[model samples]
Target: MTGDLGNLRYISPWYGGGMPPDPSLPNRRDARRNRDLFIEHAKATFAEHGVDASLERIAREAGLAIGTLYRHFPTRVDLLLAVFEPKLRDFLATAEAALKMADPWEGFLVFLEALCGAQAYDRGFNDFIARRFPRDERTEVMHDRVCQLARSILSRAQAAGVVRPDIAEADLIALLWANSRIAEATRQVAPGVWRRHMHLVIDGFRAGDRHELPEPSLSPEQLYRVMARLGE
Candidate 1:
């Protein structure tokens, strides 16, 4: 991973070379500080404005030039990877932990709560999870892993007769897209309001009272194309 990221040229003279500094080296303290500041500001900026937040605004917030931001994160996706890596790990961990639970129904609910709760807090992360960056191998891998994990969890619940068998990964993705909009609209006025809507959605997913949908779920290939279009 480091080798792949090293291809990005470090343009800041503060690092004394046109190469990215190793944050672990003692001599690169200032460079590390600047990078940290950029990440900190970028997190807050992205949260407020979504992943498409202005890079110039993030640089301004970090008290650095836009070039400095670019020097550290050569592309918007690179900066997004830095900002979202931890949260992504957390979400994956939550899914893993939920999968380990004895009851599939309980595990499914826990997974949804963790996923939706994370989305409710950060709009940028929400966008990141919703779209597919087909050109970025790293993000593509992450997206594929997340989709597989979600499918596994949903399948487990259905096998246990808790979730409707008709429910698909595409349906879950649609829920995420819907939750993102709900979270954005009521972020200030009522942050916790999403919980009500999420619970209602969950109720609809139950096998006992499932209703026939008007349209068919998107196939895996169709879902991929839709997500890719979202990124574009």
Candidate 2:
């Protein structure tokens, strides 16, 4: 997988030229340095103010013109993909390794820890995982890959009779939504508390001696709409 905008996996129309050149173009030493600065500043800014952070502020902080920022990253999502590319690779790798574990329950726990731990650190990434950007094919691909991995991880656990039979992919997403709120509220007051909260929820997921849930889990359409609205 592509690591960052410097080496973007999928080149969109916004890149000006077709593939091969890479998204961080212009090739000049100063130009490349400017691009790197934008990405570095953006990484910190987005982590602090989230994906909705100000682009103008990022440019100002980087001592670059706003037009320069736009020239390098035409859109907010473009900047985001660049900033979080490495983290995304780590996440995907974690999920893949989880799937390969011999114990399904252990794999499930490992995946959950990686997933929630990611959200607990970066607010932008928290928003990234929680929302759905339907317009961008790149974000769509990222989301689709995540959903596919999640389903495989969950299904593996369920099939092994380690997870509750009633659990669905939607439930895992619901946990993420809940974790996002918990992380936001308690990040400063008590960092790492989300882990405790996750473990509490995870206990309920285990098979055996379970009471019925009060409501049915969301359908695929409903979940999609919920995530899409979050993007809006």
Q: Over the stretch 1-232, how does candidate 2's per-residue lDDT look in tens digits?
A: 3356534434553554445644545568788899999999998888888889899999999999999999999988898899987898899999999999999999999999999999787988888887888988999899889999999999999999999989988899999889988988998999889999999999999999999999999987898899999887
Q: Which ten residues in a row have the lowest lDDT in candidate 1?
A: 7-16
TM agreement with the true structure for every prediction? 0.87, 0.86
Please report the TM-score between candidate 2 and the true structure: 0.86
Query: What lDDT score goes with residue 43 in model 1?
Result: 92
Off-target runs (Cα >4 Å) in candidate 2 are: 1-27
Candidate 1, 7-122: lDDT as tens digits: 43344535334655566797477789999999999899888889889999999989999998898999999999999999999999999999889999999999988888898989
Output the number of the TM-score-best candidate.
Answer: 1
Deviation of model 2 at 153, angstroms: 0.9
- Candidate 2 worst ten-residue window by lDDT: 1-10
How does candidate 1 score on lDDT? 0.90
